[model samples]
Target chain A: MALKRYRHDWLYSFCSVFSMIAFMVPMLTVLGIKDGIVGTLTRRLLENPRNREISPIGTRAFRPEFFEALITHPDAEFLVPETREISATMNLIAEGYPSFDGDLYSSAPGDPLLSETLDPQALSHQLALGEIYVSQGVAEKLGLSEGSELTGRVGRRQGARNEYGRLPLKVMGVIPRHITPKYNVFCSLDLARMTEDFRSGYAVPELGWKGKEKGSEIPVYSRFRLYSRDLDGVERLRLHLLGLGVDTLTQAAQIKLVKDLDHSFTVVFLALFVVVGGGAFASAASGSIDQVVKMRRSLAVLALLGISKLRLLVFTMSQAALTGFLAALGAEALFLALAKTLNSYFGGSMGAVEEVCSLSAFKLVAAAAIIVVFMTAASGCAYTSLADIEPSEGMRDV
Target chain B: MDPSPQKTKNGAKEASPPDPDVSDDVILNCADLVKTRKGGVGYRLLVESMTIGRGEHLALIGDSGSGKSTLLDMIAMVLKPDSAGDFSFRPIGHAKWHDLWKIWRKGAYGIFEALRRSELGYIMQTGGLLPFLNVADNITLPADLKPGFPKAEKRERFKALTATLGISHLLGKLPSAISVGERQRCAIARALIHAPSLVLADEPTASLDPPTADRVFELLLDLCRDSALVVSTHEQNRVLTGRFKVWRIDCRPGGEGQPIEARVAPLKDRAPAAALPAGRVSLAKSLSDSVH
Candidate 1:
């Protein structure tokens, strides 16, 4: 009993140990890689214009309460993409900030800021009514700091500066100086609504175009970019807004391709687990059977020496558990080291996206659980061998 | 009321106390102990009555088809009897005859294994030593397997076994590396190292050459001088001496509507007035009638 559990034929030993580690390490590695990819794909999928667009389906215009209803959805974030020409100076009263030709942007803060933007968080704060965040170019030209105010004139695109009304806005913050085309201003919807030009509602937008009939008389949005908190529900929200006779700008093929990629990764992970898990289990079971067949005489000898069937069974189970434990240790060591190396590799490539090539607590737990299941099947073989063994050779089955 | 009871002499009429490991006078008593099996062919083994005392050696002999091994296994409680009657061994509470050992009748195999490990030792034809273990480990195996069997005295007893068997220098070698005689000597050591009262050796010397077999048998008989040794073998010439009694076990195939028949009897030598039992006389005649 002492040597039996630890001792194995070279072939059996190599096969069992190799298969165990093979099952654990590669499965975990694939899962980590899948998670890294899924994280990126999910983010990109949600950030895609196809998933975030909203517009009137055809000739129909939005109802008076359509905007309010869409905004009330838990996942929905309403945005007005219309830009109006404005001329402004600093706060209500002061020596005044340097005024410049600045284009104003009005939208919710959670919008997917362009990847080309060097400092994404520079405009991370939400814009309140009567407040604004200026890009670095605008900030430098106006010489505005935090708590400074800018007086802007909002009117027709060709309206004269003195012809427009004065719109006083506070400069709450400044965008960092990195991204190009930095003369942009960010403000809330309420601030945009205060402008007389925007107050004159425009034509309702279609799926991809903001236009009105040659002769029509109804309030319409030039364009609106819609967003959902979770991409899983984004399609449903899109359908809801589309049901309201709105056509959203969506590349269904691109979104489906990303979603299909996500599903493929899931299938790969599961298939990898089954293939590896099945191989490990088969190796364990065969190893157990081989040991029993080759060591029958020895087992009978032990039985003759008075080791009970139960102890013999436990002895066999210990071998499997020990094998699994040793394999897990080796696999984990290899897994963690590999994850670290690949983490840096992925980090170097995907900038600012979290969770690149990292393992989860659940994977370790799953590996342990799989090892236990393997041991259980292996020990079952041993138990059967014990049950079949007779105390002595040439003895009749009784 | 005396706590310690009196021990009878060898082959005594009465059994000794429960603790027989230290006692010299001990007896194993049985009446009508029987064992049987049936299949395409049938087997019925029986021992009408018998007693084995400490320092007594019995050589069980028979023809090629005789049930010598079966008889030895039955005596050691390795095989459950077809039907057993009025049997016990001493000392009274020795594990071999304890309440647990009674499970042999109920087919409680674990109890029989425990009895074998702690109370009796078995030596099979092939040495029955585990291949992976070295000579020393095989010798001490029964001791370790026997729970609560004086674990501290193992080293001392092992040293004694090595010295007695003259295999001390070969302790570290695997069974594959050893000579046949050396292997058999190791088997004998393994049997006696645990201090079992009864040592059942089936063909202990059957596999050795004549010269090596002689030496191995002498060593076994010598070491078992203080214990109850029952050896089953075909080496009748070597065991014909007065120091050892011969027990021949024979099985006669039964006819239709009748049970398989078997018999056990003492094979005595050179007694003109002694007539063998009628059923056994003819088989005995061919042996005794021949000149030695």
Candidate 2:
């Protein structure tokens, strides 16, 4: 007959809101960190193909034997020759470059130096045939189409030289301009192989009696470039190659850069986790405590009215869980907004920012932990308050 | 005067005096009841040797702190008697029915077991209705707590009491929404709903206006006609003028007693006392017939 009043107390409402915020902070923080890590990893995975083509630094030369061995490694797909030189050359037809009027000669077609038209199959056959493919940049500069003839002197030729020296050659084909417009070229391995003065090879004299010997007398030198499946694999493969008396300075350097980036990511993740997780836990705990205290009188009244002590405890816990969940959502939204604003201000690509802000399994785990912590804290407070309420005392005017 | 008397065949008159050897009519008895309280350094007796019959109205009156409330609480079973004192009662055969009904009706035992049964009801100085429950719910609280009563019967009882107390209009209002007089009326209605055999009222009319208090007292007496009524009060005029037998607890020290002893004596006997009042006569006749 004595019904309980169902009116909401302002103090309790305020406390509940506070508790929710507290619980949410940690959950959101953890979620943010998890999202950021997973996002970065996913973006890296998605962009890996594009990123792999551009070496962080400049190119390094390798020996014919090294190339042969590297191509045989399990993860290595193909080997291509790349010659590096700085020059201003452009696709006059494509409209980005207008100043250059004269033709340009850089690297050969099918070379890594030429971003486009460096076909693996074509380059491998050409290396076998001792022919070179001219870069698109060279064709564009010279205003020459495919199969055009061109002449250029090889400066700083490291190997032996032939008589009547500035070599004349026929351009096999023009590469597309999107790969690289500046200093772009692809050449057969024979070009570098023929230069005997180069540290890793024999000179023109070593090519031996140029007219007397056929193409067989001119040794076909191979260049090796190593590619790895993963950065760790790269390091292990580099070590193995170095142990095998092969040169790997460039490969080792690239692996070192990747390792450094990984270490930096670790430090950043740790810092974020501590800050966010701690903040969320503190917020949830404070809010839960306040709520329990605020509802003490109501709890006492209910207890006297024949509601069991255990039921009250469960009720409070349920309230805490609900509040924690809501608060986590709010905090996550805020974090996302902040991440977006930061990304915009810094002019960073949205892909990376979005990846970092994405929620994942780790974020869910963090949110759950926050809820558990809040419920535990709330139950503790409820227990203390419940212990203090005596039925006779409750019936009296407070 | 000889206390034992025999009933006639019709049971309408006291037929003849009982033989001195035969003794059994008295169903409830109390002897040399002494209640004490710590006063400064010494203890004081609050009530001494108070007794009542099966169907008598005994009005207890005193000034504040005179232990009237304490005595009522003792009789109501709300408080335990001190180890040094003794109190006892011989329950009648129908008392078992009251006990069974109290347990069956109230699923859980009320703190005041004896007062809850024995057809005993209490009206406090201030009406204690649960604030959230309406007047009707407050009145039916006891019956609702128990089982075994048919719905129709309960409804009939509820309707009769509400109409008799002139509170039918206020049945739906919460206790807080009603006036003090109405709240008191509701409390009285609740106490009489079960037709208790004994009603203990502690300053039931203390907060009511004189007219309201008189009306409440009259209603209380009418409803409790077949039961014993004990009211502890500070109001001298209300008790002195009432038709019920009166007991005044005087705290003044007397012969062979402490300073706080209670001396209970009958009010001055009047010759040709007003014939049994309308409600009382019928109630007495029915009770007399039942006893015989």
Candidate 3:
């Protein structure tokens, strides 16, 4: 019966349904654009793997226990110990290229920079006792490639005398320029420790270089470079390192910008929803009131026919519910079309993984539910007129 | 009008009180029912005594503003009387009589609504068919409101009634699409479709032409053979020629500031007695079954 009434007054019903669609589609579109834009920006920030790296600004002796505890930290993805800046440099000479100095750093398993270019297990295997990995900058400067033989010479000032140690090295791999943009050389922890010891005027029996005999000393690292498990973990790891009096540098500001962008979009969307949604609600409610007033004769006839007042109320509300549900469906279809158009228009510039407008399936369902509920409430606001229709009014000549 | 009129303190004539020994054949009995319309030129309608017998045909005739519609509304229980000395109704085949005024005072509107659904039917002057529905749906609405009305029986009656009313062709059309005469016939069909024990038609043909009004009025009277009927109409000649028991409202004009007073009184001839059809079902039993 309610459906019959709705169908009988299709023009009025159409207007009400369209009003609801007008309210809902804008809200859904704004939300989708917000999610898409913010998601794309955040994804762009995460594209550079180095953005997840946290390195201390200056040097300090960090104990073995500190390294062990830091590795157990929840956000720590990868960590490697480094020697002092003075001993970390070496003069490299390749057969076909001019000699140049390369900054040395320790390399170990799960080194994200090397793992980005080569498999982690393979990279670990290649970091043997006399092997080294060179950055693309170093490779370009010294004319180095994998399997190329090179000589790394370290010179030390020994009380007005210049002492030099030479080590035979093979270029095991070259890290990508994007991963390590500076001219640097990477070697195993044992090799880096030996270099630091030789620079401190100690003997390195492995290279048969002469100096003071080695003594028992607990090894301490002057610096460490760590990568987080993900982009979001960078700030957490940086803060954790800061708690230990070490100020670390990472791309936390870029991540904050994305968060702020999300917040701003939400506020703007809410304001739009309040204004447009209020108007739509008023339109739908007043339209329902007008329809009920026009149909009071028919409603009174039903009452005169002995249909309960409660049933009459249900009849009126059922029509509103139908209108709301239909509007939600219309809004969903419109939103999908708009989202597709926007995504297509912007998809060329952004990568395939990023969309300019997007909404999750869960959000779509939730929006539909909310629209239906809202429309029903709007109808409820007009129930007084329906209830006031008297059955005796059906007796009048009018 | 053989009964003597007694004068009230306000100088209005009051008809005799209702008969205390109501027989089993009587359907409704009322006495001393009063309703006051409070407004400029206040009006009051008084029904001193009245009775509608089972299978009886009664016509209410009066001038305009004489409270014919008000009296009919009160009898139909749609309008509550301000006070009642006695108002009782016995549904056909029911052993017990229901106190109509007591039910009203209790605010038991559902009972009144259910009675209207299962036992009484009303027809308005303008053919009060729902505009959204087709003629067929409008006619079947009363039966549809009944919870367990037999669909096969309803269909059979619908065909017979529409055929009888000459409205079989207009069943698929909406009320707005039909003529006034056709709509009136449709209203008659709706009022009789449920087989109610009482049918009230208030100027059912007042909007139709002479021939159509005659035809519709005759059809309404003919189809109500097995039920009681109270019809209010201006077609006095036809009603009198049909030999229906006539009730007229007599109003006394008010003075400059006083309210007008009116009372219902029986006219000369009672309707000719007719035999009841066999196997008439009790409206109470039907109502009870349909509701519960």
Candidate 4:
């Protein structure tokens, strides 16, 4: 025997190992690429489920704790969407100020809507109790620019029966032009709460600058977002919140449908590869067993020496196991390399670099297990020959 | 004993162990043993009341279509006999047939395999040593399978026999590198390694030259000193009645063929160590090197 290679009988065994590896690489890589695309897109969508999904159902008259409980999840958004709406009348002169109905885009600091490159501190303040970014259309009509002092108010559509006054404000930068929809006027949700449109209390405090207590009627939000950790957890969280009588909505159903699609694809690929890879392994193992039968003299000698047919079969099993293990090793390396190359080529929005490319450890194990089962079953095909061997029969052929 | 039996002019002595109190007990007892397989003209074989005891030898001879090898296979338990009016081996201290039957009901091969490992030895014609193992490993192969391993006494006997067969120096070399004579020597050593009660040889010296064949045949006699040895060969001329009791089988051709018929014969040499009186070739000094 050479240092690296096995002796004559095992030479067939080594060739089988290489053939199994070659078969495994291309099949596993193709399946891995599909999984990579689905997983990455799914991850990006799941990162911000609350907004893309409609606001979770909530009651009109729940205690403040209701919103607080929803806030417990990291990505939950508790918005009063009604506050973002207003009818702007620029002035109360004989000729009213030029006005347009528009929405205020207010959010929590890490809202997916926030630009990714914004300075962290300013970004946090911009979500609430800070200067506002106005839509380009709104800025053009209002003739507003960054650092311009501006007055804010509850427009008459908020109500004609109440005596509420405009509040002072400054226009911050215009919303980045690249983000869609140019007419939005962004502000802090805290600021939005001061508008007469949200106030339902008895005394509107003379409207110089009404503190939260003077307004006293807790604002009811038209919509809110409640984020959970992952797609599987979303359903559980939704059920619990629903048990507490809060109406909720999320991308949970859509996400589940997408996930089901992904899972179905994975199962199909697994079945396909098992048939292809397992067939390859079975063929290799059968050839090796035939070689063992061809070496029947050696087998008969062992039998005469009292080695039972069952005991001698261990060598065949080990040959299969060795080939399966090496093929798994080669397949994983090739799958990972293929994933990296494809991810880099497609780049961010179009490709999922980390999530979709590399095969999961679970998949690698399953592929190996399938190959081994096929090989073991194939090796058993030689049992009749082994059982037939005898010392006298070996002599006859010699 | 046949008075016309002849002997060879070789100076080889009957090789038996050095022990003084060797027991002479019956080793194999069988009558009307029959075996048949489908689709062959050499279909059936029947043996009537063949008995061999320890420290004895039996030679089997037959025409090409007769059942010499088939009988040897049945004796070795490598093939099951279809019918045996009575068949038993009286290996001392072994399991009773009834108990072995209990094991057989679960799996027949298990019983055969266990018995082969524990009691029977087989020597194939081509020196069937495994190509991967060295001479020493091949010689000790049976010993290794034995449970309470090293079977100290058996190991010592193996060492002694290998030494006698002139294979002790080649113990570390693989079968592929050894000469045919040396490989045959190892096969002989392996058969005797466990000191089995019976040793079945199927034309064991057919691979060797004549002189080497004689030497190996003599060594087999030396090693199976206490065994009931059954050897199958086609050469009637080499049979020595003083050493071997011969049985010949022949099945004549017919449209459907006749059942195998067997008979016994004697081959004479010059004389057998002064144990028997002079005759022709001893009935002859060599049965005229007969062919039949």
Candidate 5:
């Protein structure tokens, strides 16, 4: 009966549904666009390995145990001890290119910078004493390739005489240009420490280069290479390091920007939803009252025929819910169409991977459910009018 | 023993006794049922004693504002009487009789509504068919309300009933599209669809012309032969026929701020032509003046 009555008054039903859709579409569109922008920015921020790196700003003495304990931290992903920056530099000589100076760093398995290019386990096995990996700039300038041999010179001035020791280096592979664009070379920690010791005039046997013999002393590193598992982990580890009186560099500002934008968009969306949803509710309630008043005689006849009051209430609410559901469906369709058009028109500027407007299926379903419930509650206001109607009214009034 | 009106001390007439044959077959019995309406001129309707027997047709004849419709509404349970005395109903095959006044006082509306749906039907003067439903749906509405009624049986009855009333062709049309006489026929069909134990119709043919009124009224009478019927109408010529037991309401104007009194009593001497006068709207006035 509810369905029949709704269908009988098709014009009124159409107008009611159209009005609801008018309020719903703009709110949904705004929510979708906000989600799109925030989602794209967060995705881009998380995709880069550089944002996850947390390196100390200046040289600090860190023992081997310090590296071990730091690696076990909850936010720590990977760590490798490094020598002093002065000793870490190497002068390279290749067959065709002139002597080029490059900054060298110690590396190990599971380094986040090399995760995509080389398998961690394979890299762990391949990090031999003489093997080294060069950055794209170094590889391009020196005309170096895998299995190519080069000379790495480590020199020191003892009192008056300048002494130099050279080691033969094999190019293991070249890191991608985008990963590390500077002239940098990567070697095993043992090899890098040996160079430092040689430069300090304390190594003699490992490379057969002449140097002073050192007494037994505990080893310490000037710096360390540290990385976190993700962007949020980077910020957490940085804060922990700051608490330990270590200042670190990380991309926290960019992350904060994206988060603030997300929060602001959510606030705006909620405000708009409240205002528009309230208006729609008021309109729907008025429509329900008018319809109830208009059909009082027919309802009274139903009462005269012994239809229960509960059943009459059910009929009224069911009709409202059905109309609301149809309106929500229409609104969703319109939103999808509009989103497609908006994405196509503006997505070109955001590149191939990101859209200008997008929403999740879960949110759309939740919104539709809310609309139906609101409409049902609005119709409940008319139940008082229904209860006041007496079956004698049908007999008396035309 | 003459079964005539008897003069009382206040110049009012007392009611006569019920027929012995109908006393045994009584379906509805009422006594001292009074309803009062207060206004600038207050009005009160009083029924001293009345009985409606099973399968018996009764007509209430009165002028306008003579409390005819009010009495029907009260009997139909749409309007609650201010006070009732000995108002009881017993349907056929039901061993327990229902006390109408007790049911109202106890707030047991469900029981009353059940009885109304199962045993009583009503026809309003305007042929109150729902505007949204077509004639066929309107006629079959009462049967639909009865739970566990077989659909196929209802369909068969619907076919036979509409065919009998000569409205089978107009079944698909709405009430607005149908003629006034046709809508009245559909109302009759709706009232009798469940084959209730009693039917109450208030001025069923008041809005129709003479020829159409005769046809619609005859259809109502023919269809309701098995159910006890209490119809209120102003058509005195039709009531003069011998098929119905006639009752008349006589009202007397009261003084200022006093309630005008109306009484329900059966007419005596139905066999004689001169006993009951036939007029347009003066039946109640003539009866009141003649009795006084």
Candidate 6:
């Protein structure tokens, strides 16, 4: 029966093939790309060193009272009590100095630099103790190399201190260009502590038996970075530190902002895919079902002549499968064409690009199955209803 | 013919009184049949208390919507009364006597069942031959669906029948490609292929020209020689005399709340007066003579 019908209606057969192709190609492409992107992003995030950190900032400035409590609270890891002034500034240095490069800020404490770029004769003019890394922009301007040295001057501070006011230090290692601009200049904790503007005046002696006394004035600042193993745990700790006269930003706040952005983008991408691909498949299926309904009378005659319902169903399913297969093929061709056009337009962006259209065997098979199921199910239901119609009723129409 | 009559009488004499065996002559029996149709306005009684006998031709004459077709459908087992009275039939064989009742109860059984029973046939008003099938296939459709007889035998019968109808040349053409008269002939061929005990035709000559309609009716009467025939028609002159039992259905108000009534009467006995030379009967005279 199917053979007989197919031999007579080539147009219907071709339509079936075309509908399948249209339904499958885009569905597969979208599924594959989404899976690939999510997998790649997750892997990159998990492998990064920052993902392991409990908190990126030191605990002391985050919540002073919590830090004090933690020092005696048994769960604390390192209990060396210390205080420092934190500040942010943008600086520029001569381009040729090796130690003056922007990369100096990202390096560890022992990184080497060019002595010729710095005043090596004076210890106070050497690289500051603890790690001192300069910003990438400053490194480029200073023409800094790994071993370069240069003069480092304290910049403006919001809080006042009288201990070591407005002093200069030796240039340090240049930070790598890959580091983000926000953390471009990374000075040692000791260096930030030494600057007079960082000290709370009426400065007392440094912790120990005997130390120098500076002044009695205290500085007030509104912002600080809090670091902890548990991001939310540290925020809870932050409130305690606030009672100790320190203000801080918790990792929880930063995480919330990042999550919101990620969720918003994911939803937008999915909505766009559904609106375009879903609508196209639906329209194609609708047209195919209408054609099937139009052929109901002929099918009814066939049913009366002794074709079983199951065989008729299979015939109808074959029609849908053919349409879906063709549609999938057409969709693939369209995707390929678009890929070619895109590659021609923006191939240079990817640096030595080849073919842009990537057809994976797995994706193709999955899409084909989906197309077949969708088309077959839609047309099968319609065919079943039509097949059950009595031939007497059909003749009445005549 | 005299010896055959003596043998038939002798056979009837030998049969026991109150015989359970069905007589070969009695084919169809409808006792107190009734039919009703539901329209937008209300229910309309189409047929009431209609009965037909074996090898007997019946022409149901009535006006439009007067239930002629509905009566044919009821007798053809295509429609069942809303509340049926008793309908019984002794088909060609004893085994088929019970099967006919089963087929009648279903109202619309598969066409194969009718072919299997060989108890009833129908020539639809519009000549219902499947468009895809050629004249030959249309005539041989019943045998093809249910191969009860040998292929060669069936083929021989089909050839002979088509030749008698002068449509042998059209055997290879589809029904759609043929003229309406040829199509009607083919429909008659199809209905007679199995040699059913009863043939019910609904307006079999409706689409034919007057001459063609007369020829078609003659063919129907010829075929009715071995089977009972009930045809629905509105033509007054086509009623068969002496050979058929005429029944006219009237859809008018009657006494005691009866809205429809069937007036059955034996065809007038004009056979002796209609003796004519061989092959010399005028077409109109022959039609009127066969259908009075």
Which has the greatest DockQ? 3
**For each candidate, what's the DockQ?**
0.26, 0.07, 0.55, 0.26, 0.44, 0.06
Q: Per-residue lDDT of A1-398 in model 2, one digit per residue for the tens? A: 11122123434544655555654554454545455655465455433422233121333445456556666877544355433323212122222334232223223333343333446665434432223444466566566666665553333323475332234555566655544354443444445444322323223453331322234442433233344554455555656666765545443454455456556755666676567646655555565555556656545434433345565676666666555555556666666676555545543554444444445656556755666565556545656666565432222234
Off by over 4 Å in 3: A44-55, A64-219, A222-246, A350-353, B1-29, B88-103, B106-108, B253-258, B269-292
Q: Which of the CAPRI classes, incorrect, acceptable, medium or high, describes model 1?
A: acceptable
lDDT of 5 by residue, A88-131 (tens): 98889997789988889889877777776677675666488788
What is candidate 3's local distance difference test score?
0.82
**lDDT, residue A108, candidate 6:** 24
How far off is residue B133 in model 5, in Å? 2.4
Model 5: docking quality category: acceptable
Clashing pairs in 1: A55-A247, A56-A247, A57-A246, A57-A247, A91-A149, A204-A220
lDDT of 5 by residue, B165-264 (tens): 9999998888999998888888888988887778898898888898998888788778887788988987767776788888988787665667788889
Q: Could you tell which candidate, 3 or 6, scores higher by DockQ?
A: 3
How big an interface RMSD has model 2?
A: 6.6
TM-score, chain B, each candidate: 0.78, 0.71, 0.82, 0.76, 0.85, 0.73
lDDT of 3 by residue, A239-305 (tens): 8888988888787887788889989998999888888888888887887788778888888878887
Q: Rank the candidates by TM-score, best first.
A: 5, 3, 1, 4, 6, 2
The candidate 4 chain A region of ten consecutive residues with least summed lDDT is A86-95
What's the lDDT for residue B235 in model 2? 63
lDDT of each: 0.65, 0.51, 0.82, 0.62, 0.82, 0.53
Q: Report how far off residue B71 is in candidate 1 (Å).
A: 2.1
Writing each residue's lDDT as its tens digit, candidate 4 over A1-398 gives 11111344456656776777778777777677666766665765664443244454532444456677666655444333423233222221111346554565555565444543246675565454446667666766677777766665553322456544565556656655434245765666565555534243323343454433453556656544444545666666667767876667766666876778688877887787778757885687567567577767777766665667788676555556666676677767776777777767665656334655556789878978876766666666767666677645644544
TM-score of each predicted structure versus truth = 0.70, 0.45, 0.78, 0.70, 0.81, 0.49
The ten-residue window of minimal lDDT in model 1 chain A covers: A203-212
Specify the highest-TM-score model's number: 5
Model 4, which residues run further than 4 Å from truth?
A1-7, A50-52, A56-192, A196-219, A232-275, A333-356, A384-392, B1-24, B37-44, B92-107, B134-136, B151-161, B168-174, B237-241, B245-258, B263-292
